[model samples]
Target: MILHLPAQKIPIQEIPIDKKVKLFIKREDLIHPEISGNKYWKLFFNINTYLAGNPEKPYIITFGGAFSNHIAAVSAVGNLAGISTLGMIRGEELKGKWRENPTLVFARRNGMNLQFVNREEYRHKEKLTEFLQSEFPDALIVPEGGTNKEAVEGIKMMLNDETKDFDYLCTAVGTGGTISGISEFCEENQKVIGFKAVMDNSLEETINKLTSKRNFSLIDSSFGGYGKIKDENIRFINDFKMNYGIPLEPIYTGKMMQKVFGMIEEGYFPENSKVLCFHTGGLQGIEGANLLLEKQNRNLII
Candidate 1:
């Protein structure tokens, strides 16, 4: 798969926590520039199993929003793996203009058949699943955000032997698959803190149902929910890049880092605690988001 990554640690310098506390990022974003971050791990096994179990079933289908990193990753990987991919995009208005959004444009370039639907219809993934089953029955359907048992199983690889001892593991939550997978494997002494990019509590139930471990908690850093950004979030993303030289997209990692800083200011962690964060990449979405921001007359996430 084009999604392969080796375990590597990168430090987060000058985190506001006391001198005793140390923070580092797992740097999953650096794995592959395109098929980067948690999406790569989330899709690695799903694609493999689909091909191995049903060789004749050459098609795979999945769901995503307008600028979803999951859609981008799946499309990029499918092209590499010789699989026909279909994307059930979330807005009917996006149907005709592929040039408007960078993510949609990339997916189309990679040979993905983009099917756009109304927001009301896209809310229920089961409806999309039913449609896929009826129209293309043999297609392997990966859930939105790639959060499925197979994706969770693949994500377990992100925490290997070297990263077993940290006191805490931090990551941004989208569909909750990445954190759920890490929660299962993180040792009893280590806790996982997931900062939700979306502002709903629905993901909590889904995550609880997926993993057996009680080692994780979700924190709100949505900045008014998924894909919607406010002034503070924009300032934080830009300042963070200027300070640390790491680019974070508004959808996920940016909110997560913001939450981490907020918690540290509140003295959330004990002195001498060790934390490692998984950088779930969505840097590709920046271009598309900036376009929307420009229209809103909001500050671009430069």
Candidate 2:
């Protein structure tokens, strides 16, 4: 039951943007087909540290929304490690409709047991986590989005000598763990920028507590809302793929890249500043996103 997968040296490629600022992207998405990008790093120490304890009957339990990348990654880890997994999914209505969702279907195929809880119950995750810990004492219950101290520690692997040359480190912020890691471990002169995918008001404070240094800034990148893909977003994603030959999931990477482009255009970055954005992968959500677009007779992401 070895859970420690070797982390890869993900390539940093230049994004050909006609701006004074040199824009680059870290291809973290290419790390794994299933456990891609930041999710892989976030779960790295969480799973390995738990497995190192050598608990008998190892089981993993985690929480996520229907199309959550975290849920998909955790299920993949469970399958790879030969550990049983339980997913406490938000929106109890999905219980009857889980088969329709590509992410949920993938989790099911990976042998993850799905348990749906209502929105209210999901919002109060602390109580649910407490109960689940009691029920499955041996289970490693990862927090929603796998954000924890261990996750922050794992994200350090994303940064190295190749990354230190950049003046700014950028990434799409979901649970704040990824940016927290960058802020905590980044070079003293480097500034961290987090493109917020979800409009969580408490996110700044949450990130502050996660890191001792205050070297990061958050930008509103939620073009419409979390998981609500607009026509413009779809168009941008298609154009980006066509031009850059890089696939970005609409929920996180797509929105972040869009906002980053806007910032570049608006002269948000200083001249000659080297900005690097982490392409945190969640490409698995594309199928489900395209399905929703097809139903609405909207433009699908390429």
Candidate 3:
């Protein structure tokens, strides 16, 4: 199914976090069902490129965590496209059972084959290309998060039109593929900034390796770590919803907006400087985050 999302022009609103700066959101979160936001463009490119080769392969294989949106998208899209999908998950099976997490459940329901691996093996995912090739010789190997050359190229098409001159083009950085692709396409006049969702310095190196350009800036914006959401972040998420009617997940876009607000408060952005932020989709994960927060609140009350 072709992912269809309303590409409505998201308003450029003045920051309530600070009055001097302005923020514009690219509502990619509302892109589509299953293949939503960047995931759609990311996978769209990869699948097209794979078909370009005209290989005899009938399936695609990728890696991700238990609750990974990439896995979910791949499974959903692959099923609809009549292509098989294999998910190499990073973590042990749930205690006493193989099934665990909503993403995995949905992936299985969508007919994706799942294989769990240890943390160490998962960390060496890049090095396991040979192993993966040997296992699925006829399958195309997509990098985790679908962050690859084709994925980057597909996403760049969204930024082709100049709606307005932006001082900084920002987005949440995960595997650095999205930012790297954006940075590569950015002209000398525009600065590309990425907010790290995970609390790891290695992201800089990862991005550097992805692209040779120094025009990209990486900020350590993770409140604690990946999937680590604090009360302040929850408040920000709520405030964003109340003020702009935008639902931002704490793991990615919420942290990015949090940093943007911080930069505004610190007078990092000049007065009236336009900032375009990309809302990479993963809204489904919000349910998991809310459930965890509810349990935390309940424990505190007890």
Candidate 4:
């Protein structure tokens, strides 16, 4: 199952902000309908490398939350490649209630099997991964957010001659793969800023180990912890979409962008600096996010 990346260059559009720093966004979200953005590139080498070996049974096993974009993307890869997929979903309470979740529903429609596990078990994923690998030797078991060495290698494709023109490259850091790749392959003069979506304290060390150079810095962008969306976040997402004609999901992109804007307002960036942020796509999770927001009687992302 050879998945060919789209031949066209992803567009980088300038965000006309009144701030002194010039802001632009690389539309990685426009890469594909299902496997869009960094997810596509992160899985590029992973799935392709696994398929190159030509295992007798091509199966993919991965882990994620109920609304995890990684799970959705992996399921899409399985669907596209005609391979079987198993999703180790966190929260055993969601076992009988998976139908209520959009991401899980999409994975099911893509022919992916869902396995519900308790939080304790999910917390110790290394043990679970070992067991699963022993059980299914032929399966390609991707990490929680596809943040392995191969994934970093795949993320290198996100940078190019066009991206090199920027003084600072930015992205929403989930499992550190995207930022690590940018830090690894970016030019010496360019700095990389990672807007961390999760408050993982060990993320800096993890990302540092992934890249040889120390050209990246991480800032907390978790408005109210991971996956806990705030009213301000929804408002920012809605307003940004209305103003820019670009959609951003609540978890990663929205938070990252909101923080970036805040930093600009605080004069965190120097005057005349060119900043480019990668739109690491996870738009599929927006449906589930909106469903939760609707239940809470709040404004939905448009």
Instruction: Tell me each candidate's TM-score.
Output: 0.93, 0.98, 0.89, 0.98
Clashing pairs in 4: none
On TM-score, the stronger of 1 and 2 is 2
Instruction: State the weakest 10-residue window (summed lDDT) of model 1.
Output: 9-18
**Model 1 C-alpha lDDT per residue in residues 131-199, reported as the tens digit of each score:** 778887788889998999988888887887767867889999888999899998778889899888887
Give candidate 3 regions above 4 Å deviation.
1-18, 95-100, 298-302
The 10-residue segment with the lowest total lDDT in model 4: 1-10
lDDT of 3 by residue, 138-232 (tens): 78899998887777777775575563378889989988888877887777788889999887778888777777778888898888888887878
lDDT of 4 by residue, 123-154 (tens): 99999999999999999999999889999999
- Error at 176, model 1, angstroms: 1.0
- Candidate with better lDDT, 1 vs 2: 2
* Better model by lDDT: candidate 2 vs candidate 3: 2
How far is 238's C-alpha from truth in model 4 (Å)? 0.9
State residue 125's C-alpha deviation in candidate 4, in Å. 1.1
Off-target runs (Cα >4 Å) in candidate 1 are 1-18
Reference-based TM-score, model 3: 0.89
| Candidate achieving higher TM-score, 1 or 4 | 4
lDDT (Cα atoms) of all candidates against the true structure:
0.84, 0.93, 0.78, 0.93
